[model samples]
Target: MTQTAQLSPSSVFVVSGGAKGITAECTIRLAQQQPCKFILLGRSELLETEPDYAQNSDESALKKCIMENLLSQGEKPTPMNVQKIYNKITSSREIKKTLAAIEKTGAKAEYISVDVTDTPALQEKLATAVQHLGPITGIIHGAGNLADKLIEKKTEQDFEKVYTAKVQGLENLLNCVNPNQLQHLVLFSSVTGFYGNPGQSDYAIANEILNKSAHIFKQSYPSCHVVAINWGAWDSGMVTAELKKVFQERKIEIIPVAVGAQMLVKEMDNTNHATAQVVIGSPLVPQATELDSELRTYRVRRQMTLEANPFLHDHTIAGSPVLPATCAMTWMINTCEQLYPGYKLFHHQNFKILKGITFNESLAKEHILEIEEISKVSFENVEVKATILSKNPEGKIHYHFSAQLNLQQKIPIARPYESINLEEDNIITTTGKAFYQNGGATLFHGPAFQEVTKVLNISPEKITTECLWQEISDKQQGQFPVQWINPYTIDLSMHALWIWTQHFHQEACLPGRVEKYEQFVATPHNKPFYVSCEVKAKTATSVIADFIIHDRQGQIYSRMLGAHAIIWSMKLLRS
Candidate 1:
């Protein structure tokens, strides 16, 4: 790094969206150390007459807001939250007021109103600014906005609106500005891009683009010092009252203007250019859970019962109900699809059943679905690990199921089905003797989860079944929030192969993993359906198959490419 260099008298800085913002605060702070002329660019013009709200009456308006905040806290105005409100309430026509404040510090300042996204227009204005204010050397791109909506609610327009200023604006500036003339370039990014946030996915994605761009520019333009500052929430910007409460709950400290600006100056002055990307605030990204990664409260507690979860009462072995692994996947898939609208679960890897979920007559009142972030990754893809836990009366959390999900942003409309064709009379049917030792007309399934009425055919090569739709119980229907098929029926259809496994492999077997699964339609549950499984790969110890379910009319409902299971007797440790 070069010796602490001071701003030269001829230095001219172009601050985008800096006409009136925390960027203005940083400009004033820069003036305290060394004087430099600033051309502040923004979308709004500095009016000859100040806004009606900027009248002397606003001083009272500001006080009124602070007083209400203090009343809610049941204390007098403290410097903390009061400062948050004070910074936000200031009006923007104060652009002229800001220029005057900077001039008082012996730094020249002027305002220019133009859309930063307008490449041609910005080029012209930038050229004119150089003519009036001398050479353009320093650049601070603070031009960005927040739409702040969950991914499901975010429209394409909202993404574009938030993206253009930071991503596109930076692109245009790099194209228009002469790299030889530039000494310092500052890109204002955020911690959300580094980790991940719930409502700010779009914004986080945009800033991430900026951070990558800054690094690339640094390597290409070796003469210019390109630095991307990933900042925490600042006191003097677009942050509102409600957002402040959220930050407090998450324990994210808001960077005071003076400190934040001072840090900005020091970072810019680092002449070595070794630091391409610098995170200013101490951002503690939570590794424990998904909501934690998003700065939200993670724990979810709910009351669940046999009546509420009718599917839970469906399959029982030796008088104990077992929750199917696929049933849990159903809930997780439904949820994530809603949370991230455009993303689809492409594959499920390493699904484990630690202990089966069993419910007595009283039912376990509360169970928790722990959604944790294995990693906050990729602009278009995310991966998460989930656990289904039950709290016992003694207050111990019992884990029932766990799995890793592979998510993709692009949604697939259809996939090739595994074709299975056979003669009706050639395949032999079996009764309860194969599944239950009692050898009656029933196995482990109750009326609701028992969709496979009869085995149409069975073999090592293929397995097909005849199924009748057991009307989804009103009590259980809400549990399947996904508009398509419910897990109960899907699990029942897959259970048809249980008889095959019992006869050839062992007395009983359980699902080990689902390598891949896909769905095209939420097939109607009221109509009779056919589910056929074709053996993809097989071994003496394990079996893998592809399954496809279709209604009588041949409309495909769901498909599984790599469903696998282990032989029940093979895992037995004792005779």
Candidate 2:
């Protein structure tokens, strides 16, 4: 059963670091959504009233008044002393504002002054609050301190302060509360922890500990809604003007306070309890800037097998699982996408399946994919050559697949689809069931690869068909998992050509080469889509055709032009 956090008017929440900043903002939003009692914890002591000299004064004016007061008292009005007074007054005001905001939402609010790292002190204080407020139903561990410095320059004290406030603080809170009774737990981690940043080694280490702990906690208490949000730089809170400017200069996206607070509320209400860690913001470092600095060749080795890749079982030929041509394209393109971090495959040319891997018996082998930059077609576009090959124990390399890939940093806009005229079509000769039955034209394919719903119309020159969205299960996927370019869907679009070949030439065929292939949008799976295959040329040995997968409105999803299929021996047509 899906688990969702149950928050009600009687829910009592203990929030560390909830008296100020982003935590306070989210706390207020939660109360607004469901009126509840909140016990806020912080180290800063709140003043009941502002001093007479600090009344009606802004930060700059308040600093001047503080300096003057120090001078009149016969003490040195140094910059350090002035800044200390400024911080105390500002922190007090923020705490007061957060309390008032919660009260305005018709929720009970109380502030406690205690250090989370001081375990005994925190336990004593929380025990008292729980006695009066009933029981703690939730906890938001947001008390984290940052002391950023290079490893060489950092002191022991610097590490202790930042690490204890986050890691030790959470341990203390969990120790004080009854873990099984708690319904919700949110830990505010950071992007620094997820994607390490310079001069923040200690801070990142502390947050990563929280991230892992959250997973462990969820496993121990399956009923609890636990999540550690790896937050990016925000527009408010710890990001000071100087730090904000630095993040902006680095092109790091900042999460606005309103959007982030709403996201927290939504996450708490989400029923997917299995998700323990969620990264809420963009990476601290831009991928394009980091990878574009170098253009180098890359070689990746992988093990391929039917046992590891059960998806191929659905695309069998002659009762033996064989790798589909479209899947090879996906493997090649997926590898190319990794070489350039932020770029995606825009188009590919001359994609050929030279050799096919068939799982006739217990089959397992190692394969290598080599990707090399062939051309830099300006800064926005690039071309790369990719090859998939395997080497035997004797060190003989067997080429399997190769393609020229075109990658673009930006997604290209889709153009209007060229609709096909099926006015003079023949009668429908195949239904989805008949096509997949024994002795059928598609007898070589299994249920998973049989995506064609029905042959709507067929002729010697053109064939139109309807295709189903083949849902792939996780276990069947094995090693060759499905991604954006679904092998089954693309193969369905090409199936029209195979059907035409069987009807006209009475021959078995295999996809040999594709001159060009481009995908503009992801194929919609909510409903069936149409595919049109038009034969441009044909011979006794081979046939060339063009295919397009589109919707009823003529909105194209993908297209392949100049696809050449090789005529194979009829013995290989059926098992």
Candidate 3:
């Protein structure tokens, strides 16, 4: 049987901050894509009260210069689309002109000038908009103030000014939206909220509150989707020439107009969650180094190292001493790295640690010990054999030996000299020859055969067949608290590495060490020692020794061994 599908109602969009460049363009584009009724709300009037006021002397001059620049570039200067939209929003003597302009674009547009923070006025405006248009399916609450000032220097009035516009205004708008009709709510926050910037405390706090409010709303109303968009500075009215002058003097750069708007719109369209943060700038995509420059706390580093004895407890251990510390470090680093990567040497700290032992030496020895025990061991009914061999040019040579007395099983045992003689065989023997525990067996060669070759010479004939060997236990664990003399070290390194990898390797980049090594300087009678490591490289080959490790596989194996040792040690202590 065939079924007819019913189409859901098209989305109706209401956008605040229609006067802002990015927000305005985003709102219009959203209406165009969804074929929805639109309501553009802002404090400023769309149409100028007077024709003379509409075309300011500076604006006219700017327009003339823009046209002249275009002609000189051999490009035809069509009337700017932005100017048309601006004229429609600001030129209309009344609401009719604005609606007509919007109708021409195949969408209905309405304007409301009431302050969003005025609850009653906002409610009335919302009702009027819905009656004239339709139900509101989406809203872009972009209205907010950008009042920048250092936290210590900022006044209570400055704090109120920003919060009144961002938090209060947003709360009023949220109150106006009918849950049954509203599906998505996009809150315009700023990067300042995610990562605080100096000389922007007021702005940052306001945006942060907005972000938090979105989360609260989402938690309270699961059906409604709330998104918090953390935008980088964009070329808009908020960043006017006067404001730009202030920022430039303070060394802060505003983002390009087009780029900022594109990022904001992209996030608005794709995001649907409570408290989702999306950044609007280039630095944020690859990594937010530019923003990090201003937010010092957002620049941190993390590192970890793991040691083990296979015989201690069934020879099984697994852990990184730096694990907990590294974990906390990673969190701090990621948070700061996402926010700021440029600021150097700003000290702030937080730390944590966790450790545990799962087994002991007594437990390990219970199941594993001596060649006789290994030979007599059987999983099911299969008999096992234990033998030792010496390395030769031809291959390994098997050694024959024995244990005393009783033979309860049909297993075979081959042990060499009752006491290993270093002079003759150059081999060492331990009291415990072989032992099995935790699904594996461990064979110990005492202090006399500590070297690799000594043990290799007396290796089992059929190593795998003789016993199943697992990871070792009883290991050493430790962590380091690293502080950078210059915090920009990691940030610059990451950026340089990223560029090199993208331009040259075109392959995944590995984490490279950032070390300061100690060296000795010697004079005739006096000697001094210092530490240093080359931080930069002119060629990839030059970086091999200092930045890259050739034996990563071996390093990883060693780390695993260390982890096993730590785990086993902890276990032993616990037992």
Candidate 4:
């Protein structure tokens, strides 16, 4: 193996086997453009060969032919010699001079002779080279070997030989390097590491090990950047002429090495994360074939679900377990709160203990009653109504009622008669009318026409009377012979009582159609009362109507009180 270095006076670009094929040539060109020195690490023998023909034309064709010949002879090739031959075949002298030209451009150049299999010696040589060139900032471990023997034909030594040189060499490099000085460590892996082929078990295992080693190194030194470039099949000496023939016959396309190297450089420049696995040829192909297959299956399942008819999907109602009616009530309460704040009936006296009432029985059998207590002094009355309507969605019942009051005095008082003096009146007689009043009536008794009577002084009789007046006809005052008073006095009392009764009635009404002022009708006298009755067809259902009353202004009087009456008549109607 021959090594070459492209160098600027300050920095060295090191290429192992720089005089070899496209890999070596590309490395020299990259060194030329960058401001760096170069140190090529390779065997001394390859450096002595001419550029035109450093080795025999069949030299690239040697590994497989030798392996086959040895296998046919029933002799297994020694692992160490196989590795030595692999390294030697990859080294070239002309590649080294090309790297030297890059160094001539204001850069330095050097070559270090070292065997990778000797870990300590290799580390010593690398450290010496870094000391001479300057502290090493990056290292690309591109050295590798491949074999095309099937697992059955492959000996354990074959596997160990390839893996140790490639995987172990990279691992040793990571171990020997000072992590604080190195910014990037690039490992060249093969697609075979991720996807296995029929006859490349040894090659696949080596590459897989290399990939894992990169990850291990990265984890061990988190600050030190690591990258594994899983390159596709490249046209190189490693892929010999005979192997190329086999690959072409198998319709496998070889990837250009330049493209792979460029991608590696780009990824190394990226500072997003320290570790990355970059595949060169196909973007979609996963690094692992088994994982790729599983992903594809999952995608297919998801697509089938997406393609199915939406209508066929099941949509069971979701939420807390609750009866339909109770759920409806909860929803209604929430909706009411949202629409009209402070209008919700949850805390009303009638709305308390909501869940216990039966809608049907309550509305049908219960008669609404309103009691009023009237005070003559304040002329105010307190009215209370009791009735049951259909349970509101909010679990409240309604009632309807009216009240009347009469305010009258119903007692009579007797009046005293005039008194007379008789002692001094015997000589003088006086004539006077004697009058007496009793129980609101005037009368004269014990008096004759032109009577000589001793009446000294007489005062007008005074009488007081009261009556407990019941409602009577307006025209019947004369027949009863009682003092008639303003008829409106009684009417006003009744009207006031009616007003008081309505206040309680509305309070007791449930929130529904009738209570909501829909069925209520306004009368000519401006009284509000519900005229329409709602009948529900089912026991579980309810009907709502509005209660309308008339206002004093003669316009139709209605207020949305939310009165709902449940039809309890369902059973009776069914019967």
Candidate 5:
């Protein structure tokens, strides 16, 4: 791909996460070459001029971040509080310079301080773009946040800070803009998410989500040229001197700001002639030796969320999405595979869902998913736990989704969520969307919650269907760090069982609680998969069923055990 494919004169672009760092550098350079109208957004509101503290020696990046956090919490901000205003003031100066550079190139540019995760505000910004710059032809989604901590020590806020910008921000941009007219959707991802990092679980997942999103969005919106670049750490903006030294020690090279800008221009030309995802810089492969003492306890930690994982928001019961036990097992087994490569999950025991890990939208605004290993590995075996954790204003940890996963080897392969691939030609394919839309909105599922792809078989004793994860680009969105459907997908899948029950019971039934469930193998999101359910037990008030999520080669990605469900009355709708 040539680095000289600059935008045409009439090109209008909207870029999130562009106020500073590599994104800001790209903004200035893109305008210099392309001379297009650019809309740059940042979370921190910047003014037109630099403040007095901008020239003071006491101004440091840390001080600026502290002031920004305090002001976000509404601690009574004022320009008189130069300590509070200097960081923002400096950011303003940088933004002004970039805008001026863009203008000097005979281009028009403006700044709008808005949170990408805030859907309504993003829509308003989209409206403003239409009003001023006309239809948006390009969108460089470069929004992201940093919260580096070991999985155990990380808070949900840490997770959201990183994701809301990248994951949810992309969703907001896709929905608000004219998809048909969009020519380029460039997402700035990171290498950490593709490989693995000791203290950057949340960061990894957030970027990985972008990687998968790029491919799926390409398919969903054929007119839009989409690509996600899994970038390495940059020398300017976010990379501090201390962080740079740490990155150097890890064998990760810093990408020059100028080089990255040119790369963006090259990718916009659809360099490979396909909507592809690529990584520019390389990071060292993760090793046990790299584990800091805090994370060295044989227990590994990983974090996830709806921003980079919007599918979690889909599966709802009585109105909230709950974590499926299989999702927890996937986390545990994947963590073990990371520690013990060349080995998939052989066996798991005592795998129980202690409580439903609800991915509530309101709660998610301030929290994230944290998976941690509680006990050390036993030869050929391991144990881990999953939780939704956050820190209170007082700095204490708040926890949820408590579950245990025990991993071991040398076991039989025959199990649920495990099956031979049924030929697509033989399977009776049906839209799960029709099921939910025709009935069960009260089941707390809209279009996004429709997980079933095809029905394989249904009878009095056994019923089977495919929970093929066809990425739904309608309504709300989802994260891309997924190979299989989330817990909500698993639970919503059992709705097949309830649908089959309509042959006799004549009413809907909701999942009560997971009696036992575990992951058999890790699944990737971009594959075709299916699920099967068998009747375990049924009673007057409830029923129990078993189910699994697997792919064509019969590779079992996840399984559910003794899923308990209760009869629920719901109003149905039909087209």
Candidate 6:
């Protein structure tokens, strides 16, 4: 289990727009969880006492009393006047209640009445607070305003008010404190920013800025637990009864106050600093045209460079860095996952390498992954046609790899497979150490790809070997970055086929095609697993085989069925 970075009791938190509503609720909950000092920043000034006319908690009774008092003072009781008076009294009451609640939880609560957008005023107030309470340990940037209008109908002032409150207010807070010293930084974003909503263009833009800023700050200060939660509609705060009805009708999930608060605490307690953006609650419905479009082809472009991926330095072939077939599958699967959220690549079929990406020659610097079509095969399954392509200066596209990917919402059970027996009948000809070191001279791979430790048996029918993967330490993590699949382990499985061809045909080879690939679980490191390479057919130019990685009990971890490798000239290995 991952250890959580719990908050300290001495921690001081500065919350913007925290005196009332959702921010107040979250702040109070945090205080309840860990008794800490909270400096609430907002525009409302806390009233010491309620007026005689507004003493009643009942809204109708209080409004009636206020109207009677206005009449007695020879003042008009118009709807606008009544509402203005009602808002002031009720807002003050809420702020007072929040402060009292925090104090009841054995936490210090101080309300600062200042507009967060006023940079100079905010700085002065925060400076004085820090002098009294010491440096701030965390910040919850929840200051935001909503100006709901279409782009053409929205005014410039509307955009300025909504955008400045979130973007500029966060800037003011960061300027007042040192972000590097902060232990936790939470920015309340919205689903509208992630999935654009109508009549909220300004709001969407402001919230998206918050999300982007969270990433920037987290990267700059790796120790700080920064997260921009793209929250859905909540049951309280700005979500009115009418808004709740609308959301329910649209099938949008409403996050309850208690649930949302608990989730916030959990997020703060999490120690995974790599996660900077988190989306909670149900996703908004996309337009029918987006999902049902017949002509839409999703495209993802990424730069291919050896310098960027340092792992390639250890996957050199013929003394040159070459992209491994496993890494190629990873790129394609990653793109598919990105194009379609909430779905994972369960299986890959017809994965073929039309042309390998060789860095030793004129290779494309940028590659494009295109999902040409998505065919729904069943309610829970979909087949995706994805291809990787590149373009030269002449604008001619070259297809490098293509595959049919099967995506599913749930993981399927692993199918049973046959295992190898290294009994006395099966003669052991060479050890894996000898094969890679000197016995297998045609095989050229760096240390990272050399995972086969011992060869138990080798023949025309099959070859069994012992494999081990060394756990990379933090210092060497940069060279072999973590991925969905271990590049080295899969490379080792492919190496089995190469060894078979080298043993029989005396030819060097590279993985050309894979009939099918299924990954059930991650290959554990620093543990010995057996690889059984069963050759079905072989020729002078190519060798076809099935590879399996399993434990001593024959429980399969992963399988590559019908793996095809193309034979290369002996001169290439000598080079």
lDDT to native, each model: 0.70, 0.82, 0.42, 0.40, 0.65, 0.79
1 versus 5: better lDDT goes to: 1
4-79: candidate 3 lDDT, tens digit per residue:
1111235667788753456766655554444557788876655435433234335566456556656777877678
The estimated TM-scores of all candidates read 0.47, 0.79, 0.47, 0.40, 0.48, 0.65
Highest-scoring model, lDDT: 2
Ranking by TM-score: 2, 6, 5, 3, 1, 4
lDDT (tens digit, per residue) of candidate 2 on 224-325? 888999999889856888887877766788899999999999888874755799999977652342344456788988887777777776686777878888
lDDT order of candidates, top first? 2, 6, 1, 5, 3, 4
lDDT-wise, the better of 3 and 4 is 3
C-alpha-based local distance difference test score of model 5: 0.65
Candidate 1 per-residue C-alpha lDDT over 441-472 given as tens digits, one digit per residue, 9 for 90 to 100: 22455666665666767778787777776676
Per-prediction CA RMSD (Å): 21.8, 4.9, 23.0, 40.3, 16.0, 7.2
Cα RMSD, model 5: 16.0
Q: Which stretches of candidate 5 lie over 4 Å from their true place?
A: 1-6, 49-82, 290-337, 340-575
Per-residue lDDT of model 4, residues 1-575, tens digit only: 11112223454334444435554555554554564666665544444544332234455466655555567779887766655655554454354655566566555666666545678877888788888678765666666655568678887787777777676776666666666666666667778776656667777778887788777866765555667778777776577899778676545678777665565556655534534566665321111111111111000000111112121111111211111121122222332222222122211122222332222223223222222222222212111222222333465555332212222122122122122121232321222222111310111111111111222221122101111123333243211111122221211112111111222221111222222211122122212211111111212333232222222232322222333434232122112
lDDT by residue for model 5 (1-575), tens: 32222368888899997767678778777777678888888887777554433454345654665556557778755545745466566677777777777789898888888999999987897797679787888889988878888899999899988877789999998888778777777889888877767788898899999999989877777656677888887778568899888776556788887888887776675544453588888654443232222333343333446555555655555555655454554555555555643233544444444444566543433544555665544344545554545554676766544455554543345554334435444333455566555345323455555556666776677776766555555223432224322544555567677666664667677555665665655444445566767788878788888777676666666677777777666543111
Q: Give the CA lDDT, 0 to 100, for residue 2 in model 6.
A: 31
Q: How many residue pairs clash in each candidate at the backbone level?
A: 0, 1, 42, 47, 11, 1
- Which candidate number has the best TM-score? 2
Lowest-scoring 10 consecutive residues by lDDT in candidate 6?
286-295
For lDDT, candidate 5 versus 6, the one ahead is 6
Which portions of model 4 show Cα errors greater than 4 Å?
Answer: 1-19, 43-92, 104-107, 238-251, 273-275, 282-575
User: What's the lDDT of the predicted structure labeled candidate 4?
Assistant: 0.40
Instruction: Look at candidate 5 and tell me the lDDT of residue 87.
Output: 58
